[model samples]
Target: MSAKVSAGKQVFAIVKKDVLAELRTKEMVIAMFLFVVLAMVVFSQAFGVILNDLDRVGGGLLWVAFLFMSMLGLNRSFVHEKDEGCLEGLLMSPIDRPLIFFGKMLGNLLFLSIVELFAVPIFFVLFRLEMGASMAGIFLATIFLSNIGIACVGTLLSTISINTKTRDLMLPILFMPVIIPLLIAAVSATGGIMSGEELTEVYGSMRFIAVYDIIFLLVAYALYDYVISE
Candidate 1:
């Protein structure tokens, strides 16, 4: 019990340190937010007629923005640690490797969610997208579910890429192929919500996302120690 408690505290400490660092530097989060907003604005201007059928296409556009934004954020997730020489120290610390993975993964998740919250309203405004409040809960739930898989898979792969010579280039290559399944489910769920499709299909997509997140979480838990040590 005490061991579990200590591990929990370490994870929270990792998260808190990341939050404080982001507040100070304001680099990663700011860049992600800007990328998302600008992408949408540009699309709206250049593809106005195409965007008219938002209900059908908006979900794809939203995922494209988020997928890239996630890549930007995930690419930077470990920059501070790697550049400041903290990665070595973090690995050497007494905290369990699993804890470090969770800590970093949770931090990534939080930052991504924050950017999404701000970006989505702007997306709604620019695109004139709407859904009944009855559907709002499902809409938000779908996004949050997808975020889990994004954070989970992104963080695990990031640990590998951060140590590479071509870290930036390596991440997308590793991330893209692995992330396709999750992206499909996410787009399906959100597109269903936007199109006011039946609830059952949305629920099915959400379930698949939930399973994907769980599988990745377990994979990360099992492999992080080995991955981070190398």
Candidate 2:
């Protein structure tokens, strides 16, 4: 088979396997959902009376909740594969290593997106915030870009973490420092738009996230083979 065809099959197989595993176990969904709701409930109680400015703070809170919740989900994505010894199978495949990274990142993004779809609306309902049209666009764009960043970096880190005595706990310790910039950029962009800032002001933060996405994605692709091997 041609290299391209072989790689394509491997990527598809990885993606399919991840999707089915997630659907059957619902591990990521359940973990993320429970975490999200708990975060919201805690926030609601913390700011119970001061909820007048909820809209102003809503965007930051939403992304903060997502960032932490996603860590839980991303860690689980790799743990499942590791627990089942599937990562070894993937490493033995003839396809390029970058394809494996891309496939895993894609699957992580899909699961995270689904959980956010439910979480975002629930946030609005609980807080009573009006995300204006322009703000809504920026919010969605941030989610997409941030998810890409998270999944790309998270996929590589999970591989590293899985080999440690601390398997799951190691992921956040490694991932949080790397993702701080991305989270800052995402929160700033979302908050700026939600607060009715002009697009020019918001552009800087959005560009930061875009650049982070590109840089981390490349880093993941380059390091993924080594990760799986080690």
Candidate 3:
């Protein structure tokens, strides 16, 4: 019980530290927001004639924007820690290494969630799409499940990429292939909701996402200590 409490506090502290630092900089969030919105605006103009018909393909476009925006944010998630030597400091601290992984993962998850929370509605509005409240709940669930897989795989891979000279290039190389399965499921589920496809099929896609998140979360948890040490 005591160990659990300590782990919780350590994780919270790391998350708090990252959040406070981000609030001061306001850099990652703003950049991600701009990128997502800019993608939408560009798509809107380019596909103006088909804006009304976008709902059929809206899920694909939405995930494309989010996937890229998330990569942008993930690329920076560790820059401050690595630059300031905060990662080394944490490594030497009493906190467990797996806790460090959880801390970073949660921070990524929080940032991704915050940006998407606002962006999703704006996305719907921008493309003149409407979703019933019932379907909306499932839509959000699909995105959140996919976000978990992203944060899990992304946090783990980003840590590895940060130490490389070609980190900016390296992250995409390492991250994109691993995340493709989740992306497909997310797009399928979200598109189903928007296109009013069968609920059973959408639920199956969400289940696949949930399984993907769990699998990677375990992989990251088991590997983080070794990953961080080098």
Candidate 4:
């Protein structure tokens, strides 16, 4: 019998299912956490004390770490789904497709948010860099918008990668080019904010991130059927 679940309920159920599965396995979260931390530490060592000077390119270093870390997290999230054939079952469900998209996105967002939350605080602690009000707000906005962009597109691209022989390496190759605008906007907005630039300076990048999210999310929703059908 088909269950009579609301759209919201279905989405929540999917999100909860993914979250609990991840929590139990703790694979994606732990992998992402360790990957990000290791990346940050390596960056710090490579850049040395230069990163401590917020006057230079500290913000850039942070974003670079995040950008790579996001890739690791995104790939892992979908890999988990693909590994157990869970995604196939999701497609078999009676729930709406967009619900699946949102559910997957929500699950990814949860992990990405957790990674950023922990990573950013540690970044500040290790780097000892303090951000201004505007920069702090921009930092928050970048994480929010970038996560949306990553989740929206990552879900589709991961599906694409799953069908490929090179599922592991294929994701970054396919996903990075597509998400360039997101990275550019996110990096620029973050850079401006960290440099204590005026809000007016970074607003355009913020707008770009917003528009990119809207456009990609819509396109992904429309194309998801095709992606998953294979």
Candidate 5:
């Protein structure tokens, strides 16, 4: 019980530290927000104005924007720590390494969620899409589940890529393939919701995402210490 409490405190401390630093700088969130908007504009133009097939393609476009925006944010998630030598200091601290992983994952999740809150509405408005009441809940659920998986795997890869000389170039390369399964599940589930499918229709994709989140989260948690050590 005491160990769990200590771990919880350590996690909170790291989260607080990162959040405070981000608030001061406002770098990652701003960049991600702008990138999301630009991607939306570009995608909107490429697809042009769709009259009938919006549901079929909207989900793919939405997740594409999320995928790139997340990569941009994940690439920077560890750069500041590496630049400031904070990564070393944190590693030397008495806190457990998995707690550090959780802290960083949560920080990334928070930033992504904030960006999505703004992005999703803008996406719906720009695409002239409307969601039924029931679909709204499922759409939000899909976003939450997908973000968890992205944050888990992205955090681990970010740590690994940060140590490389071409971290900026290497992160997306390492990140994209690992997240392909997640992107597929997210796009499928979201597309189903947008198409007004019944909850039962999208359950399979939802289950895949949940399983992906659990599996990668555990894998990342187990492997994080080694990733950070080197």
Candidate 6:
């Protein structure tokens, strides 16, 4: 019990540190938000105003924007730590390494959630999506679940890539392929919500995303120590 408490505190401490740093600089969130806006604009232009099948294509475009913006944020997630050699100092601390992973993952999740909170409404307005309240709730839930999966996997991959020579280039290559399953599940769930399908209809995709979150979270937790050590 004491060990568990200590681990929890360590995780919180790390999360607080990351959050405060981001709050001060606004680097990652600002970059991600602007990138998302740009992506939406370009996609809106490509698809044009008379989106006959927005229910089908809008979900894909939304997740594509999310996926790419997430990659941008994840790429920078560890750069600050690496730049200042803070990561090495943290690793040398007595705290368990997995705690660091959880902390960083939570930090990433929080930043991504904040970006989505603002971006989603803008997306709906720009695309002229008219979702019912229930559909809006479901769409938001899908985004939340999908963000968990991205944060978990991206955190691990960012750590891995941060140590590489071509860190920036390596992250997208390592990240995109791994997140395809998540994108598929998220896109499917978002489409179901947009189409006004019953919740039960989209429950399968939601379950898949939930499972993806659990599985990668565990995988990342198990491997983070190794990645950070290298």
Model 1 C-alpha lDDT per residue in residues 29-134, reported as the tens digit of each score: 9999999999998888888898879998899899989989999999898998899899899888788899999999999999999999999889998888877787
Q: Which candidate leads the pack in TM-score?
A: 1
Deviation of model 5 at 153, angstroms = 0.4
lDDT of 6 by residue, 40-74 (tens): 99987887854678988888999999999999988
lDDT of each: 0.91, 0.83, 0.92, 0.80, 0.90, 0.90
In terms of lDDT, the poorest run of 10 residues in model 6 is 1-10
User: lDDT of model 2 at residue 177?
Assistant: 95
Please provide the root mean square deviation of candidate 6 (C-alpha atoms, Å): 2.1
Write the residue-wise lDDT of candidate 2 on 117-227 in tens digits: 898888888887677776777788878888899888888888788889988889889999999999888887877877777787778888998899999888887887787
- Candidate 1: the clashing residue pairs are none
Candidate 2 residue-wise lDDT at 41 = 95
Q: Write the per-residue lDDT of candidate 4 for residues 113-133, one digit (tens) a residue.
A: 888888888877877778767
Question: Candidate 4 has which clashing residue pairs, if any?
Answer: none
Error of 2 at 35 (Å): 1.5
In order of appearance, the predictions have TM-scores of 0.96, 0.93, 0.95, 0.91, 0.95, 0.95
Alpha-carbon RMSD, each predicted model: 1.8, 1.7, 2.0, 1.9, 2.1, 2.1
Give the residue spans of candidate 6 off by over 4 A. 1-5
Cα lDDT tens digits for candidate 3, 1-230: 34444889899998999899899999999999999999999888887877677767899889999999999999999988899798899898888899999999999999999999999999988787888898899899889989999999999999999999998789999999999999999999998899999899999999999999999999998999999996
User: Hey, what RMSD does candidate 2 come out at?
Assistant: 1.7
Candidate 4 overall Cα lDDT vs. reference?
0.80
Task: State the lDDT of candidate 5 residue by residue for 42-110, as single tens digits.
Answer: 987777866348889899999999999998998888888899898999888787788889999999999
